[model samples]
Target: MLSSHCLNDDPWNKFPFTGFVAMISAVLTLMVDSITTSVFSRSGKEEPHADVASAYTPDQEMGRSHHGDHGLNLSDDKELGSTLQLLRYRVIAIVLELGIVVHSIVIGVSVGATNNTCTIKGLIAALCFHQMFEGMGLGGCILQAKYEWVKKAVMAFFFAVTTPFGVVLGMALSKTYKENSPDSLITVGLLNASSGGLLIYMSLVDLLAADFMGQKMQQSIKLQLKSYAAVLLGSGGMAVLAKWT
Candidate 1:
């Protein structure tokens, strides 16, 4: 197995295989829900209107026509919707970090399990920069959410210790660590696939979709172009980093 780590001989990676499987299952569930909602919404079909008149009141109708007319509108209804959306973004950010934490831990575990000084040197620097940028993104979302101090502190704590916790866990399991086993490959592949799905969904749905489909980005072709360029630059930089990882 001429793979990423020494061929099928490392057990440290295998130790987290069960956790990877569970996370993948959870991600798949969310992906399926997102897909179903998207498809159902696009068809403009809802369960046969159970008493349409009762469902939509005169005030509701007026709100739909007026308040919901524009994303930028400052009506009570629109404000509520926007507030909910902002909260949703923060929740997604928190969950995204949770998913990211799993991988981060695995990376830490690998680093801790190894005695290679050269690898450790690069890992420390790369990880520091990676965490910094990820924190910036998460912080922006949190600031927008306007959560209470305690909640913010809890989220921050989770992000701060995730990798270190993984490192410590890996150190504990180093005795059983075998990095190149067949089990490890399947596990890593699945974890990567799961994380990839969650990230893609969050990026497209919560972040890009909300803004890109909103009045602001939709109205400005130049802004849209610049945003696309920015996404490309960020993605390209991450891809380059993968070469080293």
Candidate 2:
């Protein structure tokens, strides 16, 4: 119920805003990394199922040669590369969407739980900015995924409602919900931690590594360094926002 292991409170009871829990979180994250890596390695040998809804777009179709092509020529390096990029985009997009949706839900719940109108306005503002950037990134990925209209509409709908859904949930529970209760503490804290981990991994591996370590970014040291600086700047901006928000 608590993370306190301190001398007086035996910090194990209320550990949050503490280093011990942070270490445990890191350990948990490490465990997640290892487990996922092992599973991915084992599955790597197996063929992946193809999604017919987003199999290939007209542009991909046009990449084919005039010769009687019995099937897709993945033999063409450029075409193969493009296919890989599209797959990468789709995967990252889904992951990012899930992460942001969870995050929005949490933020919305907090806002909904609060009765102060002034605080609500600030929270709503933050949520808007947060979702705006997330939407831009997710939109680009979905575009690359080339999903059918129905699927795209579904994603858009979920993206639009995630925060509102959470707010409604919070309001519904407000009658009996106790934010200071142990259950609330653990539930919300763990949820935030999980979303944070997912976002971190997706940004680092699915995005940065996939791009920076690719032939494109690897070709020019100057471009790579510039990208690094840009990322650092972005990190600082988020850090400042965290300080206040």
Which candidate leads in lDDT? Answer: 2
Q: Give the clash count for model 1.
A: 12
What digit string (tens of lDDT, one per residue) describes model 1 on residues 58-119? 79767655753456445644444444454455556666666667667766776776667887
For candidate 2, report its TM-score: 0.73
Total clashing pairs for each candidate: 12, 11
Q: Which residue runs of candidate 2 sit more than 4 Å off their true CA positions? A: 1-85
In order, the Cα lDDT scores of the candidates are 0.64, 0.68
Instruction: List TM-score per model, in order.
Output: 0.66, 0.73
Looking at model 2, residue 86 earns an lDDT score of 55
Task: Give the distance in Å from residue 125's predicted Cα in candidate 2 to where it truly belongs.
Answer: 2.8
